[model samples]
Target: MDFEQGSINISDDVLKEIAFRSFIEVLAPDEKDVKKLKKSIEIERTPDDNVIVYVRTVAPYGQSLVEFGKKIMKNISENIQRMTELQVSAVNVTITDVVEKIETTEEEE
Candidate 1:
């Protein structure tokens, strides 16, 4: 937004936070997952002032990586654009690992 005096700028940290929160909302991650996510989200600002988001994460072993990546990309891009009113040049999702969903027995729960 622009005013007579100046314009409001969203910082890279804020953008990063939004991206992080957006990922959590989509994934509904657990405690262990949250820790991993904290280190995996990064924000890059382009010369033209657009933003690029890079996310490295683990996916469920049986899920399709392509569709999974697209899901994450869409969510991150929409969130950053909506919250900051800034263009997202790209949302690059790199699948770092694939883990199986561990199911606990009734007695262990």
Candidate 2:
């Protein structure tokens, strides 16, 4: 979707892309694993020009709703400055859910 005509236009694809990029940048993965982690996140635009980003993140043993929300806000702010010509009032992130970590062991060949 296009958020260029004075209204926030977004689709699932766009939200996923934004969430993936934002998460990767803020979380700083050891490697680029967009496919593995992207599906666990969701993002939406609020009516007041704020962005709502939700994620089921891993690494610190538990999810940090506050930290994640801050990251998303920063990302959205930066993006608005770099990509858009409109004035962004603010970015509000809401962590609707959390995911539990499960141990994964890789088998040696």
After TM-score superposition, the amount by which residue 43's alpha carbon in candidate 2 deviates from its true location, in angstroms, is: 2.7
User: For candidate 1, lDDT tens digit of each residue in 50-75?
Assistant: 99999877777788989888988999
The regions of model 1 sitting more than 4 angstroms off are 102-109
lDDT, candidate 2, 42-92, per-residue tens: 555566645555655543346566776677678855765455443445555
**Top lDDT prediction, candidate number:** 1
- Assess each prediction's global lDDT (C-alpha) against the native: 0.80, 0.54
C-alpha positional error of residue 97 in candidate 2 after TM-score superposition, expressed in Å: 12
Residue 20 displacement in candidate 2 (angstroms): 1.3
Given candidate 2, what's the lDDT at residue 89? 52
Cα RMSD, model 1: 6.0
The alpha-carbon deviation from the true structure for residue 42 of candidate 2, after best TM-score superposition, in angstroms, is 1.1
